[model samples]
Target: MPVRAVVVFLNLLLLFFLGPSMAWASNGPAEPPRPALTVSVQQVDFVEMERILSATGNIRPWQDASVSVQTTGLRLKAVFADVGDVVQAGQLLAEFDDTIIRTEIDQTRAAIIQAQASLEQATQNAKRIRRLMGSGAVSQQEADQILAAEKINQAQLASAQAALLGQEQRLAYTRLLAPYDGVVSAKSAILGAVYSPGQELFHLIVQNKLQWEASVSSRHLSELETGTKAILHVGEGVVEGTVRQQSPALNEQTRQAIVYVDLVPSPLVKAGMFVRGDFKLGTREVIVLPRQALVLRDGFYYVFVLEENNRVALRKIDIGQSLPDGVEVLSGLVAGDTIVVKGARFLEDGDTVRVAQVAADTVPGMASVTASGAAFARAGQ
Candidate 1:
């Protein structure tokens, strides 16, 4: 072989072997920079939280009474009050036919007048006979008989007066009056309808006073007492109430006890309205976190906790009662734990995060993010 040809073949062989090594040396593995998320963080702590017992109930009148008629076999002449009408005590609610009652009263009065005249005549006659007997013009037995007739006439007069008074009472009964200050809830008596005694003419809610009848579990009865405060949710409004009474026995089917809470008057509340109420039993120690820190995923609750080196880890938590400011943390957390309050929804487990704001310690179990900590978050926005 020629020397030049031999040299070219050796060079080609060397190039083929060095090409793979050179490429590997120039392009080696490189680490990519981790994506950092700017977020706000809060420090959570244990708090003295209220232990509230929840229950459902209905709004009812505090003093419901059925206004009824006292007289029987009287036709309803007029109805003065209708349903939803506010009436005062002794206010006429309905009227029965007073024609017969008045007529009887008039007849009794006439009878009384006649009996009075008869009594006066008998008294005069008895006096005259007694005087004559003293002079022997009348016998003693004859005078006694005259006096007896006088006594009978006087008795008849008293009987007539009693009958007239009774008839007057019956006449008053023809007008059904409100027993108390109340709002008429129902009316069953109709005009010209003959009603018997004790028949309910109208149903009244005394003074329009309403109450919440809450059904509490029998197990929680021990925690309740008269004068305990309660909060009722009625028609998008909140009503304050006090524990007025409680049932002595539990409902056989529901295993619940009825608790009556007298409510303050509110336009939003009405009788027979189904409502929900919360009874504040007492306070208890519990871990609390801001509501924004909680994340709901697949029906589970989670929060992003700030780990060492500014890294975040997704943590599951068990939540208890919800409060006006925060929620109760049942488990899976401890005091002094840092959690992402804002911008946690866009983060995942092990994600690197830059804490924009660290909340200040203001309220128990909750800390507000510092103004400086939020600088980065604001800038990002």
Candidate 2:
């Protein structure tokens, strides 16, 4: 009896240690157990999205005209335009003292008159001398001297007339006129300061036109072209613009090119204001997933791809442009791949997940599932 009891106890100990192994071997490997955290799964889809390039730039005038004096040595008498004043083409912006110019012009005109009278007298003398040249009534040397005097007087008249015209033009320069319709951005003209030739008096924003000069990377130069649409973020509002031109050469130091975008004149925008812009290259089809699906690990982006048997596998993906709707997956994912959108942070590689809802077109009750997933995401957050 004692031997039988000891055998029964040993049998019970063996069963306790090896019974579960025997059962597991008979049933084959048991399926993976699900995690406690419930998650939402979504299938990636190819959606048409606007491809945009983001860049920062400055606002400037479409045409900046420097208003300067063409003539010199005149005292500024009056300034009719100030900074921020709008003037039309041919409108007088300032005036110089015309007293000296007019006096010089008058002197030149008088000199011309004297020269003309002397030239007439010389012509008559030369004619008489030519008539007497062969008759010996006048010496050859005397006739030659008469002809030379006539030529000299004619040259003097021409010089004097040219001087008179120059003086007249200088007189006109005393009245400074707006070269075109523009808003005066800067003014340097004083009430009595004498201006020198080519001295800048005012800076004009031609036609009050503004433009955005964006410095973009040279890599994207091929994508941007003339007439490309861009949106600018201005103060408290947004402005639409069109690409007008691109720099022919890249900056040697920065490897950046200047993209000139013409902007409609707006009160909120001003020259030299730094702003942000988005260039719309065009539309393209790309696979996109919601932001919640992305997980950052060790500075790289990853997503939890749902596999068969409700198991999740960690996948590293390359990302591109990020939009309000979702993030663009450049690689490591494809359409029809199911990814964990919520509770991704709670998962590990090969973790079995309880998908409370699946977001897909073919799935029935998709609206309800999406709503529930949104609520679950909110709760998880």
Candidate 3:
């Protein structure tokens, strides 16, 4: 009977300890597993966008003419041509005194005349001797001597004539004349001032035509073609031109190619002024996205777009030409697809997103619904 009481007491103690644990385990109905998290997302819609290739360059002369002196150490007699002067071809700009040259020519001409008179006398004697020989009145050796003397006199006359011709040609070089019809943009020659050979006296630019010369990177050179249109923005006005010349080689210093665009005749544009321009290579439909929507990670571009069933899908995009305002998605995107422009880069793929309502004017209804659904999924999760 004592054993029985002990066993009953042990059983009571065990029940006391186990009873609370069982009650605690049963407390609060088993909670169902929390739903997967949802992230709000939005889609990108396609729209018409202008695709352009842009560069900057400087305004320059259509043609530059440098009036250079041909001879050295000659004093300029008159320098009537100045900057802004209209000049025609063959118009005299300056002249050196031709007194010395004229004197030399006259002396040479007198020498030539004297040689000619002597030659005439030698020829007459040779003819008289030859006629006497033919009549058997003169010896053959005497006739030959007279003919030789006449030849020598003729050579002297020819030498004198050549000297006179040389002096006259040198005199002609004393006057500097306009090589082309152009406006003088610069002048350095002064009256009575000496100019060296190849010294520039005046700089001229073709008055009617203008060119926008821009240096472009070699990477952009392949797209260049004759007749390509370029738009130059100088200050507030726009200068439109067409590509008339493209260099086949790159510049040695900058490794850039020089491109020339012919502008419409306008007085407002001036040479040597820097300007920005856009060259249109060609046009193709591109997927345009707001710049804010893109995220750069690990040297790659990414975007998050909302999918049906409230799932946010992360996408890697290949970016193309990006302007100041937006970026162009060259690959991994298509038309009619929705991309989240706002708060897209902040979220991850497969994460539920809450999309705020955008105004109808701001975004299309279809895109907003897709965004809202993703957000609702995230909230429920």
Q: lDDT by residue for model 3 over 149-184, one digit each (tens)? A: 999999999999999878887788788788888888
Please give the TM-score that candidate 1 achieves against the real structure: 0.66
| RMSD (CA, Å), each prediction | 8.1, 5.3, 6.5
What's the TM for model 3? 0.73
Q: Write the per-residue lDDT of candidate 1 for residues 22-73, one digit (tens) a residue.
A: 9998899877547578887766666677789889998989999888888888
For residue 138, what is the lDDT in candidate 3? Answer: 76
Instruction: Rate residue 22 of model 3 by lDDT.
Output: 90
Top-scoring candidate (TM-score): 2
Cα RMSD for predicted model 2: 5.3
lDDT of each: 0.84, 0.85, 0.75
- How far does residue 105 in candidate 1 sit from its true spot (Å)? 1.7
Model 1, total clashes: 5
Over 164-271, each residue of candidate 2 has an lDDT whose tens digit, in order, gives 888888888888899989999999888889878999999999999999999999999899988999999886798999999998999999999999999977788989
